[model samples]
Target: MLKTVSGTGLDNLWDDAKASGMTESDKLLYRSNLLGSDKRVTNYGGGNTSAKVMETDPLTGAEVEVLWVKGSGGDIGTIDKSGFATLYMEKLEALKGLYRGPEHEDEMVGYLPHCTYDLNPRAASIDTPLHAYVPKKHVDHVHPDAIIAIAASTNSKELTQKIFGDEIGWLPWKKPGYELGLWLEDFCRKNPEAKGVVLESHGLFTWADDAKECYELTLDTINRAIAWFEEQTEGVAPFGGAAHPTLPEAERRRVAAALMPAIRGMISEDSHKVGHFDDQDAVLDFVGATDMPRLAALGTSCPDHFLRTKIRPLVVDFDPANPDIDGTLDRLRGMIEDYRADYAAYYERCKHDDSPAMRDPNAVVYLVPGVGMITFAKDKATARISGEFYVNAINVMRGSDAVSEYQGLPEQEAFDIEYWLLEEAKLQRMPKPKSLAGRIAIVTGGAGGIGMATAERYLSEGACAVLADIDAEALGKAKEALVQRYGRDMVRSVEMNVTSEEAVAAAYADMAVEFGGVDIVVSNAGIASSAKVEDTTLELWNKNMSILSTGYFLVAREAFRVLKAQGIGGSMVFVASKNGLAASPGASAYCTAKASEIHLARCLALEGAPEGIRVNVVNPDAVLRGSKIWTGEWLDQRAATYGTDKEGLEEMYRDRSLLKRSVLPEDIAEACYFFAADTSAKSTGNILNVDAGNVQAFTR
Candidate 1:
């Protein structure tokens, strides 16, 4: 059975039945997972866990003590066995002799490889010494919000004494390194009765000889803090009471949709960015707080928080009583420029002699009063995670401010961690970003084969996609599959009828708020009709033109609006048909509509050239595999026109091609990818024929 003190406390999740059969190492992993499951215990990737276990030496076949800790850049919440770095306990103990005191503590990380036990390829983290030097066999270092709240308070040391007395100790702030590990070891030596220690402005460190005890101790420590805060601050107003009123849910979303695209445009001059909007209760309370600007300027107290969210967030001047989105838009660029200037100044003041050059100075987190928070990054996950870290910071601020004066880390200390040599080296080791890493694309008729395939290709190349379709059921399925494959942050689905002007505009707004802005637009929604000129009714002709011609225009117009708002050049891939270039018998209405799409691309290409927005067309013929269009009456109509049955239509089209190869949905998808990517940056207003070498459809 799980144990809990009250409604507000964390439930003790350890199951002895589950841990009974596991090895000591596996038990350590199980404990880490349980502790990481709640943000109240630790935020994502913000903590490390370790255990000392006996292992067989590969060479001597003799048992030896080994230290197993979470590797560099590993998240305890999702980490597996392979994510742990194995180091010899004796070798780690030997590192103390080479350590030349605090000034040169960074050099200790260089010697960690020498401590590798069993030749484990996983790199050890800087926190390894902190965990290894602890006297106990099991240890955890986590940035739990409840504990950090006390750690970040101005009276943190006294607060710690009041809360837990001698049971839990406190230490002055020290950058995590070999020296900090020694500091922990020394503190333990002096206070043999202490359960753990809170590192000022950093996080909590707890240990026990047994993995289960350590895990339980961590939970108990955090729960005690939670209960104390709840009891003491029962009637206190959070963030000194809200100074601004929160807008209705729909209004908040509307404001976010409007502001995101403009802000995305100004900041994306360096590289395209994805955006995440958060309107959680904590964020709303903080953003509306009277002290928000002051607290935000002071920045986050924890290094892990600021590392992802930047030193501080930019507060947007948005008021719910007088929501002036247009006025805000006019001032957005200047606001961003001022932020960049402030960041540059911060760098100049705090940079060390060997500091890396200034990075993208634009703020990662944006705070809007009466609205919510918005975050942008090179990818969707980073953007969302950055928002999460900011939320954690907000939680810390709420608790500390209510009970005691909250304090952010000193500016110089924050900069030192932000531009640390070790951190810089770790960043340099990351793989280069993908070609479409930050690009956002909107695919019309996204549930269809061609649209789905194109979205997949872009997603695989690191682009976030918004799939728009009239088919709600099919759209949901497509979104689900894509989300499963690419992660939830990278895919969104909006029910949109491209033929409706309002629907198209709403879809673009949804995309803008979901991502930062649009960089690529695939106008692939279409219809097929087969009738001789004499037999074709006006209704059929209008239907084809409404979906194929006007729908392209609506989607493109909205894309251009957002693309221009962002001030970034974008790609427009219009999926026309081979019939547009080479007319087919018995399909006058479809041919005319597709032909209109071809000409529309040329016209838009001319208008968009000055803006660096490339417009092109991909003309695909007989894409039968997985094509919804081919599965309908058009298949029978085309087969009858060729004097064959449905099964023979694909063969007839394939054999008719000069290359005699069937054009799959994937084939058209490749063409769309080319036009959307930088590989064709130099070419625009051109048509590519993907019909297995169709001579008739060939472009001159």
Candidate 2:
């Protein structure tokens, strides 16, 4: 059943605005927020809303009816009045008279900018004319999952008629433009009593004189359709009662450990774009279902999905516990190639002049019971959104199948829409980005301090930052905090002890499942130790080595393994110290462990070079500002070594350096980003010193 939003907070929006003369748009924005906030009504960036406002301009003293519709490049849920582009409705309606149809969407779009009332106008959504053509004061269009379930089914026309009867109209598939708007205008003029219309293989549209009424109509109509469908298949069992078991959380992590890397290695090779992965219970259940092979063969239920999930998702037929990780990956590679071949064939079948060349064939990959679901894309948000759409699509089809057979748009219809000019324009609305826009990054010990700083840097450049740390509590807080800046789907936090191979492996696998794979590994997890070489106990040496040396080995080696599998060259940055290059008395354990990791990194660099992976080291010294590494006991030791307090030691180290400057964590992060990005494309097996001009630590 569709749940309607409460009017409890509606007064709050009008409270302060009433004294300031609130316009009709203030109410429309409130209604749009009601629809936008619910995923059941509209997935991310997949819906549009509008209000036809007749307002008198203060300057011109002229009353004009204008359409304020959702603009390009904004999500309706969090949108405000500014997100709605104001267009002259009469001028927009006149566009219907000039329509020749079909391929003229390009020319139709040109008039939109001219119709805007603002000196600097935002681009209205492609569906602008449809809202203007409707004879109602308010219009709401949403790709509700249930609506799509009914609309995308083979019996869409019949089901649509059954649910709404004479009150709803049905419009055949026509790309959104002046022609479609004119056709809709004629249909609504004929069916004046209809509350809404079902767009064949697209979405739903409801209209009314009131914004609230339009929203309520959409919910009520869609819910009734859902109810009728559910009623038809009363007492039905999902998947014929077959079991689609999921692995235990621990086991799933272990599988992701090996699988994410191999998949990453297989698909990418020295590319600027990064791959990300996502898995959930629904995704796992869908992929692990007994009839997934057949169920997944049906194409996307809606066209917007094509922009993210591609035509069809790939299914992996291996177990997570497969003894031969390499062999299983090799077989998976063959399956991927086969999927590509099939995709190419499908594209050729629908080939036309405007047809886009085949996209990367690995948009969505279904894993077996042990591995769960894996969704991939060029960026983190896209990967997760694509996964959400696939999961929703799978469930929608399942529901549609329970009573009636499931069906999507015909091959030709989907292709025409996918390659169509208006739809393609919607995707290009976002501004350009850096090369790191699609890259996946991981910062060990990332819950706070340097790790968090590094993670923030990656996110600023549009990379997905996975904060891997041993502290589960801190990790959760970090994820929550980062979400406010980069969005909820852009940041991920995984708890893993970097020294434990099982944990490290599972972390990567989970990363693979959550994001497609890893491209940049910042080996920054470590602890400090200070003792006279003769007085250094076995415990002291072990603790330092476990975190500083062994941790680096596991994090880097596992990352390399995945990179090798991806066949995409990547970057490995070990955060060593200046103490590793120059002897620091009484810091035997910390110095030796750091040295070992630096040497190990060079070895990795030498080995990883052949596959396009570049391994490097960033040796930063005297970085006490906001660093957990130099706190408490470590701080005491450094101060003791200098025969002074913490502040005095920092000052001594700063002055010892040629530049007389204190190094910060961000300074080191900058160096790490440089190596990971394409800026240092030709460099490898090198150590860059970021120690405020430490001559001894400088690389020749």
| Alpha-carbon RMSD, candidate 2 | 3.9
Q: Write the per-residue lDDT of candidate 1 for residues 1-700, one digit (tens) a residue.
A: 1121222888888999999999999998999888777777777888999999999999999999999999999988888999999999999998888888899999989999999998899999999999898899999999988899999999999999999999999999988888889999999999999989999999999999999999999989988999999988898888888899999988999999999988888888878889999998888989999889888998999999999999999999888889999998888888898999999999999998899999999999999999999999999999998998999899899899889999999999999999999999999999999999999999998999999999999999999999998989999999999999999989999999999999998888888888978999999988788888998999999999999999999999988888888888999999999999999999999998999999999999998999999999999999998788888888888888889999898999999999999999899999999999999999899999998988888787
Which segments of candidate 2 are over 4 A away from where they belong? Answer: 1-22, 103-106, 239-258, 270-291, 318-328, 354-358, 365-372, 425-430, 471-479, 698-700
What tens-digit string does per-residue lDDT give for candidate 2 at 139-186? Answer: 998887677777777887887887789898888777666677777788
- For candidate 1, the per-residue lDDT at 38 reads 77
How accurate locally is residue 320 in candidate 2, as Cα lDDT from 0 to 100? 45
Best by TM-score: 1
Residue 377 in model 1: shift from native, Å?
0.8
Predicted model with the maximum lDDT: 1
lDDT of each: 0.91, 0.76
TM value for model 2 = 0.90
